[model samples]
Target: MHAITIPEPGGPEALVWAEVPDPVLAEGEVLVEVAASAVNRADLLQRQGYYDPPRGASPYPGLECSGRIAALGPGVAGWSVGDEVCALLSGGGYAEKVAVPAGQLLPLPEGVDAVTAAGLPEVACTVWSNVFMIAHLRPGDTLLVHGGASGIGTMAIQLAKAAGARVAVTAGSAEKLERCRELGADILINYHEQDFVQELRRATDGAGADVILDIIGAKYLDRNVKALAVNGRLAIIGLQGGIKGELNLNALLSKRGAVTATSLRARPEAEKASIVAAVREHVWPLVAAGRVRPVVDRTVPMRDAAEAHRAMEAGGHVGKILLVP
Candidate 1:
């Protein structure tokens, strides 16, 4: 099998596609013949030597993929060889074939193709688990998502809207915000010029957002707390803006706000299975109903994953950038 490997982490140029040994399936895992994979910020961090794959995970950078099942490992059931599936992976999506835990697999949605489905798993599970399951965003609630034009942000906008929540997004430009608006975003703040905290508060008549899906971590922590409505929930999923910041406990206390931070890659397999199951039950039907869909910026060949990484770093894409194998 051929896969993207990093001989030495540096930049996008570090992603090297070369022949590698095929992955041997572990118990409760399956072999997936890769069709497509998606670029993510984590992939960029991995390529730059800032993030390493979890212990025992694949060395490759990709975290999600869509492919057909080639074979299953012991203890795996309810799926078969030749099944068309998209899966959440700990690593190794940027490859010809990958070994995936059966519990992380999701059947392709009714109207989505293999390439497009490649972008769904990570964003779907990330948003659903944080916004719905943990934060308990309800109908009439408002969700403010940073990096609104991103894969996770785009998915968060749609899912929040589908659940009858008002969606607000912070993007770098008007065009990207327009794209987010088309996806049901109600309040748009151009972070380059506007203050999201003030804008969000104004949009909600000073009530602020009921939930915030934050990707910019510490750089936005103070404002994220300020942007919250009473009892609001802030789910932090990325640290693109650096890792440490002082939190205003008094401000958080005044609002009775709660904060949670999580990463899917290092979670236990059983926890991932639970999230996948919840997504299949709650989100798959939304796709089938045409109420939710993937937002892909473009597709690049698997060998040219470096190009995809460049696009993500450029921060101009409106959604997921895919890599076809």
Candidate 2:
């Protein structure tokens, strides 16, 4: 099988297209013939030699893909060969075929094409787990999502809004903010021109946001706590700004707030299975009902994986960037 891989980590230019060994299905796993895969910030880190796939996982960089089941492993039941599905992968999605644990596979929503379904799994699982599962965002609560036009951010805004929460988002430009607004964001802050904390406070009538989905960690940590409402919950899912920061414990205590940081990729298979199960139960219905849809910025070929990395690093996207395998 031909896969996109990094010979030596550096720039997107380092990604090479070449033949690699096809993945062998293991117990509870399924072999998927890849149709498409999506680009992620984690892929950028992996390409730069900063992030490594988990032990016994594929060395390839892709994190999510949509495909058809070509084969099923021992003990995998209820799904047949040729099932149209999209799956969350540990790695190896940037190839013609990928082996995924059965628990991580999601049936493609009715009416969604395979190429678009490829963009759903990672953002769906990531946003659903963080915003709803971990942070406990509830009806009438307010959520402040950083990077509103991002793949995860767009999904977060829609999900939070659909759940009857007021959604606020911060993007770098007016155009992106407008897009977030169209996606159901109630408050739009152009982070380049406005201070997010101040804007959030003002938008929430000085109460601050009840829940915050943050990608910037260190640089925004202190101010994030300051911008949090009483009893607020903050879920940190990325470290784009930096890792280390001075957090004011006093602010957290004053607001009676808490912060939870996590990543879906590093979780044990059982935990991911739980997340997938929850998503299938709760969020998948929204997709089926047409209340949620995959938002793709563009689709590129798998061989141009380097270009996808560069686009993500340069922030030249409003939604998911996909690669057709």
Candidate 3:
């Protein structure tokens, strides 16, 4: 088998595709012959040596993939060899073959091709778990997402809109904002030129956002608080803006707001299974019904993953980028 390995992480150039020993499946796991895997921001961090895989996970950068089952491990049932599936992975999706826990395997949604399904798992689980399950965003609420052109951001916009919430997004460019609009975002703020706090407030008649899906972490924490409505929920899934920041407890207390930080990759198996189950039950239907669709910016050959990483770091793509093995 061949997988992308970082002998010493440094840059996109560090993602070297080379032959490696095949993964040996453990009990309750299955071997998947990888078809495609998607690039993520976490993959960028891993490539740069900032993030490492959890203990016992594959030493590969990818976190989600679509593939066919080659074999099932002990205790695995209800799925068969040769079944087409997409899975959320702790790591190792960058390879031609990966071993996945049975609980993480998801049936490809009806009407979605296998290649495109590669882009769904991470974004779907991340957005659904954080925004809907954790924050409890409901109909008529206003949801704001930062980095609106990102894979997570694009998924968040569509899912929130489909759930009857008014969606707002902050993107860096007009083109990205226009794409967000096309995905049902009701308010689009060009973060390079405008204040999202003021823009979202004005859009909601000063009620502010009922829920905020934030990625910029520290740099946006203070402003995110200002942008929240009373009793609002802010879910932080990324710290791209740096890790340290001061919090104004008084402001949050005044609004009765809540702030939560979570990561899908570091979650326990049972918790991940629960989130995957929720996604299959909820978000998959929206996708099967054509209410939501996979947004892929482009696909690159698995051998050229370095190129894909470069594209992600360039911050030019509007959605997920797939790596076909």
Candidate 4:
């Protein structure tokens, strides 16, 4: 099996595709013959030596993959060999084959192909867990998604809208915001040209957002609190702007808002399985019905993952970047 390996973390150039021994499946796990994988911002952090795979996880960078099942391990059931599926993984999706916990596997949504399914698991699970499961975004609620043009942001926009919530998104450019609007975002704010807090407040007649899916972390913490509606929920999933931030507790208190930060990769297997199940029950139907769909920026060869990383760092792509094995 050939997987992307990092001999020494530095830049995209550090990712090396090398022949590695096949993964050994454990109890309740299955071996998947990888069809494709998708790039995430976490992969960039891993390649730069800032993030390491969880203990006992695959050392490769990918956190999700789509492939056919080659073999199922002991205690695994309800799925068979040759089953076309996508899975949420802690690591090792950037390989020819990967071992996945059976619970984390999901059948490809109807009308979606293997390559497209590769981009579905991470974003789908992320949005479903944070926006619907945790924050409990209700119908008629206004949900604001930061980094609206990125993989998770795109999915968040569609899912929130599908659930009868109004969607708002912040993107770096007008073109990206336009793309978000096409995906059902009701309000699009160009972060480069506008203040998201003011823009969102104005769009909602100063009621502010009922929920905020934020990725910029500390840079937007204070403003995010200020931009929340009464009893609003804020789910912070990324720290792109740095880890530490000063929060106005008084402001959050006044609004009675809630804040939560979570990471999907470091969770226990059972927790991941639960999230996958929720996604299959709630999101898969929407995707299969074509009310929601995968948004792919482009596909690159697995061996050339560095190119994908460069493109992501360049910050021009609109959605998930697929890596075909």
Tens-digit per-residue lDDT, 171-272, candidate 4 = 988899889999999998988889989998999999999999999999999999998999999999999998999988889999999999999999999999
Candidate 2: segments with Cα more than 4 A from true spot: none
Poorest lDDT segment (10 consecutive residues) of candidate 3: 196-205
Candidate 3 per-residue C-alpha lDDT over 285-321 given as tens digits, one digit per residue, 9 for 90 to 100: 9999999999999999999999999999999998999
Q: Please rank every candidate by lDDT, starting with the best.
A: 4, 3, 1, 2
TM-score of each: 0.99, 0.99, 0.99, 0.99
lDDT of 2 at 10: 92
Tell me the TM-score of model 4. Answer: 0.99
- The local distance difference test score of model 2 is 0.92
Model 4 lDDT, residue 94, Cα: 96
Residue 158 in candidate 1, Cα distance off native in Å: 0.5
Off by over 4 Å in 4: none
What value of lDDT does candidate 1 attain over all alpha carbons? 0.95
After superposition of all CA atoms, the RMSD between model 4 and the true structure is: 0.6
Question: Model 3 Cα displacement at 58 (Å)?
Answer: 0.4
The true-versus-predicted C-alpha distance at residue 312 of model 1, in Å, is 0.6
Alpha-carbon runs more than 4 Å astray in model 1: none
